[model samples]
Target: MELSEQVAIVTGGSRGIGRAVALRLARNGARVLVNYRRQVAEADKVVALIREFGGDAFAVAADVQDEYAVEAMAQACLERWGRIDLLVNNAGMSWDTPLFRMTDQHWHTVIETNLTSVFFCCRAVLGAMRARAYGRIVNVGSLAGLFGNVGQSNYAAAKAGLIGLTRSLARECALDGITVNVVAPAYIETDFVEPLPPLLRTWSIETNPMRRFGTAEEVAAAIAFFGSPAASYITGQVLAIDGGWVMP
Candidate 1:
C-alpha cells in the first residue's frame, strides 16, 4: 500500500465517488491528477483539499467524451510526472429514462460519456504503460449495470460496456504487468443519490442488505485496492461495494 511517488489520475474527481477516490489515493501517497469536465471550481477545490492534506495533487480539465482532450490530459500528466502508475476511469454521465423514452441524443450521450470515455483514456495511457511494463487501471461501474434498474436503460448499457472493456483491457495488459478491474458501487449516499425522491431513495436504502447506503469512502477503498501493488494478481474482475445488494 506504500504508493509513495506513484502518479495517478482519477477522472471526474470534482465530487462524489470520484473525489473520494482521488483523496484516498493521495492519502496513500500518490501524486494525483484530478480531472473534471464542467466543474472547474469543484475540481479545483478537491485539488486544494489534497494539497492541504500534504498530498501532491492538481486539477486538469477535460471532457472525457472527447478523444483529443483525453489524449492531452494523459500527455499533460506524463509531462509533469514522467509516468503514470495508476488510472481510475471514474468519470461518468447518466440520466434515467425508459427505453422508448430515451432519445438518440440521450443514448449516445450516456454511452459516450460513460463507456467511450473509458476507452479513450485507457488507449491514451496504454502505450506508455506498455512501454514501461507497469500499470494499474480501475473502472468505476455501477450495480445498475448488473441488476438492470428501471428507467436507466442507457446507463445500464453503458456501464455493462465498461465491464466488457475492463475484461478486454485486462487480457491485453496482463502480460505487461498491467492489471485492470472494475468496482461496482450501489446506492452510495452522494449528491447523485441525495436528490432522489423520498420513496425512491427509501427503496434503495431499505433494499440494501445492510439497510443503508454505501459511503464514497467505502467505494474508494475498493478502487484503491485494485490499483495497489497488493492486487497485482487480481485482474479482469469486478468488485461490488453495494452493501450486499447484489451478492454473487
Candidate 2:
C-alpha cells in the first residue's frame, strides 16, 4: 500500500474525477475524507464504497469557497486523523458564458469556486503539513487553462490561476517535503461535459489525437500519482491528462 496509514482530503469527492481520486487513494490504504458541498448522498456512497472495500473513509461537507468553512474542514480532518498527508483541491464549477456576455456574478462564482477555493484549502492545511514537514497537494486543473477554449474564459482563467498557485506554493514548500502539482484534464467523460453542444463535442474529439474523450478514472490516476510518495521528487509541474490534446 503506497499510502498506507496516510490521510487524504479530497474536495468534490462525491463524484466524477474527484470520486475516482478518493477511491484510488483509499485503495492505496489512505484514510480519506470525501468533501462535498451539497451532494451528501453521493459523498456517503463514496465513503461506503471505500468501507466495503476494507478502506477507511468518511464524508465531510464544506463550501470550499468559504475560507472559514475550509479552515474548519481542515481542522476537523486533523482532529479525526491526527495529521494531514494529502490535499486534493478538486472542488470547482464552470461558467460557459462568452467573455463579452459574462456577468460579474458568473465570473466571480467561477473564480471563487475554482480558483479562490484552492487558495483557502491550501492555506488551511499548510500549517499542519509544515509542522510535520510532509504533504502532497494535487490541484485539479483543466486543459482550458493551457489552451484557451470558447465560452470558457472564466474557467480557463481560474484554472490558469491554479497552475500559477501550484508553482509558487511548490517552491515555498519543496524544502519542507511538501510537493504541489496540477493535474490538468481535458474532456473527461463526466457530467461536466455531458451538456456540451454536439458540434463542439464532436470537434473536441476530432481535434484530439486519440479521437475520444478521456475518462474520469484516467484523470484520477494522474492525481493519485501526484498525491503519492512516488511523486516526492516531482513538484511545481502540470501533468495533462488530455489524450494527446495537449502536446506540452
Candidate 3:
C-alpha cells in the first residue's frame, strides 16, 4: 500500500518489531519518526538504513509512559512533518508471573507500559489526525491476551484492555476519517524471545501449525497494512500474525 506523503510515528522503534515497523512504513512512502525509550544507537541505525534506501526517517527519544514526553513526541512530529497520518503503538513490555505470585509493581509496570502508554500516545496524536481528517492507528498486541498464556496475567490484561480501547476509538474517530486496529502476534522470533529456554522454544515451534517461530518482518507487514490507505475500511479489528495459531 502506498502511503505517499503520509507521516508516521512508530513508538519503541529502536529495535525488534518496532524497528521492523519503522523500516516498513518508510518503505511504504511515509516519513517516519522513530520513537525510542533507550538504545539511541540502534534507533539511529534504523534511521540510517531507511535513508540508505531513499526513505525519510528520524529518531526521537521518549518514555511513552510519561504524558509529557508523549506530548513532546507528538509536537516533534508536527513541527517536522506538519501532520501525522499514522500512529503505531508498538512500545510495550511483559513481566510474567502467575496470579498468586504477582506483585503490585508487576501489575502496574506492565499495565502502564503496555496499555496506558497507548492512551498517552494516542491522545497526543488525535488532535493532529483530526485536523487532517485522515489517520491510521495500529496497536501491536499479542495472542497471549486473546488466549491467556501461563504466567502472563499482567500482560494479558493490558493487551485485552488495548483491544477495548481500540474499538471505542474506532467508533469515536470514524467520522473523522481515522481508524484504529490491533495486530496480535504470537511466538515471534525477536530479541524478546531469543533468551527463552531452548526447550520452550522448541515446544512453541512444534505446537505451531506453521512449525516455526514467526518473523518480525512478517508481523511488520501486517502492521504496515493496517497503517496504510489499503486498510481504510478496516478498523476496530484484531489481526493475528501467528501462522494459524489464533484460529479455532
Candidate 4:
C-alpha cells in the first residue's frame, strides 16, 4: 500500500525494527520524522539513507517517556508536515529479571519505556488526528505480551498493557476515522536478541516453526500495511509476526 502525500513519525527509529519501519514508510512516499533518544549517529544515518533514496526524512531527538518531549515531537511533525497521518509507536526497551529479583527501577524502566511512552505519544497526537478525521496508529508490541516469557515479567506486563490500550483506543477513535492497532513479534533478529545466551538462542530457533528469527524488515512490512490507507477499515487488531511461534 502506498502512502503518498502522508506524513509519519516513527519512534526509536535509529536502529533495528524502528529503522526498518522508518525506511519503509519513506519508500512508500511518506515524509518521515525518525525519533531517537540517544543514538544521534545512527539516527543521522537513517535520515541520510532515506534522502539517498529520494525520500524525505529527518531525525528528531525526544525521550518519549516524557510527556513534554512527546508533545513537542508531535508538534514538530505537524509544524513541518502540516499533518500527521501515521504514528508508529516503536520505541521500547526490556530488562529481563525474574519477578522475585526484579527491582523497582527495572520494573519502572521497562513499563515506562514500553507502555507509558505509548500513552504519551498517542495522547499528544490524537487531537490532531481527530481534527483531520483520519489517522493510523500502530504499536509495536511483543509475543511475550501474549504468552509470558521467563525472566521477562516486567516486559511481559508492559506489553500486555498495550493490548488493552490499543483496543480501547481503537473503539474510541473508530468513529473519527482513526485506527489503532498493535503488532506482536517474537525472536526477532535485532540488537535486542543478539545478546541472548547461547542456550536461549538455540532453544528459540528450534522452537520456532520457521526455525529462524524474524527480520526487522519483515516486521516493518506489517507495520507499513497498518500505516497505509489499505488498512483504514482495520483497527483494534493484533497481528503476530512471530513465524507461527504463537498460534490458534
Best-fitting candidate, scored by lDDT: 4
Which residue pairs show backbone clashes in model 1?
A: none
Candidate 3 segments exceeding 4 Å error: none
List the candidate numbers ranked by lDDT, top first.
4, 2, 3, 1
User: 1-248 in candidate 4: lDDT tens per residue?
Assistant: 38888999999999999999999999999999999999999999999999999999989999999999999999999899889999999999999988999999999999999999999999999999999999999999999999889999999999999999999999999999999999999988999998899999998899999999999999999999999889988999999998998783
State the lDDT of candidate 1 residue by residue for 180-207, as single tens digits.
Answer: 9999988888888866779988887788
Error of 4 at 228 (Å): 0.8
lDDT of 3 by residue, 83-127 (tens): 999999999999887899999999999999999999999999999
lDDT of each: 0.92, 0.94, 0.94, 0.95
Candidate 2: regions farther than 4 A off: none
Model 2 poorest 10 in a row by lDDT = 239-248
Q: Which pairs of residues collide in model 2? A: none
Flag the better candidate by TM-score, 3 or 4: 4
lDDT of 3 at 208: 85
Quality of model 2 by C-alpha lDDT: 0.94
